[model samples]
Target: MMKGLYCLQNAIKWYEDRFCVRFTPTVIYALYPKEEEYGWPQPWPNPDSAGIYIFLDSNKTIVYIGKASQMGARLDHYFGYGENGKCILKDKRVDDISYVQCYSCSQEEPYACLSLEEYLISEMNPKYNKTGRTEW
Candidate 1:
């Protein structure tokens, strides 16, 4: 029994890595949109900016998080075509979307939005964020 259990654990880990399960926290936030009334020019006062996004399941669980230089454009991808020309909306698992806009302090900074996004993901430990081992 011990040997079988060990094998199973290893198999699961292998599958996870193979599927790129160890995703950065920002990836989770990039999949969803923030509540309305946040207003246009998102993360306002800083137009033409970058930020992180999140995708939620029907139960309001965070399934994915991601960072993007152009939050609006990245969001379009989630609502429309996926990498393989597949429609994400057709996927029954995705129920809602939201985002938090994080503007960059300077033009040279990279992944600035991602930093805050990662912190939030680690703290929240949302249900759909399978990449992190923490329990919410």
Candidate 2:
């Protein structure tokens, strides 16, 4: 049974890669709104804060990791429409989303989320975080 599950997961991952869709734990959690007593609010403000997010599938596999200057905006872009093939939600391979908020070190200091993202990506070795592992 374990072997079969692994094979199925690998096959799904292969299809996702072919479609350029990445997954991580954070991404999986963000797909659904948090349960609220008063329901949900409209027009959620974009998280202007910088942060690193991970994308995961239903099985909780770390498929992708990314850093963003404006976490909310970047996430919104994934759900929004586009013609240049930058939208991950449109790819249909990603079924879930989640994110972690990162606070700045100081008012003047640059965002540390990028560094954290690099570290996590390196340590986890996610399949979709290829750019960070390469030198320009």
Candidate 3:
């Protein structure tokens, strides 16, 4: 699992170089919002932060890779509400979600982090990615 994270970070950087989407790899651990922590509509951590996230099966296999400018909002969409986000939610294989923030990417440059997301999808070839694995 730790090795996967390291490769993920490198893939992100490689994607950035290929697409000119520069951003700092300030990896931060993101957690799911717990009902006990902040009540019904729990909101404790910075929801507006941007980052890269992944879903793993119980055996720690990479199931999906995603990214968003607002980490909380993105997580909520999948774990809480959002039709499109249901892709991960509906998948029984996924048991965990983890994230690493694109700490220095500014709001104005959303594309900067997208490259990282793309890299992870391509390199990892996660099951849930719509595009699947690229042949080249």
lDDT per residue as tens, model 1, 54-79:
54554334445566786556655545
Which tens-of-lDDT digit does each residue in 2-118 have in candidate 2? 122244246435534564543221212334345641111223233555555555544546666666676667756556534643233644655453322222222233344555556
The alpha-carbon RMSD values of the candidates against the true structure, listed in the order shown, are 13.3, 11.7, 6.8
For candidate 3, give the lDDT: 0.55
State the lDDT of candidate 3 residue by residue for 1-136, as single tens digits: 2335566667766776787665555424333323342222335244676766665544445567777777667766655434543223433354455432333355767766666667577677776675544222
Candidate 1 weakest lDDT stretch, 10 residues: 1-10
Q: Stretches of candidate 1 above 4 Å error?
A: 1-47, 56-63, 80-91, 98-106, 132-136
Best by lDDT: 3
Model 2 TM-score, 2 decimals: 0.50
**TM of each candidate vs. truth:** 0.42, 0.50, 0.55
TM-score of 3: 0.55
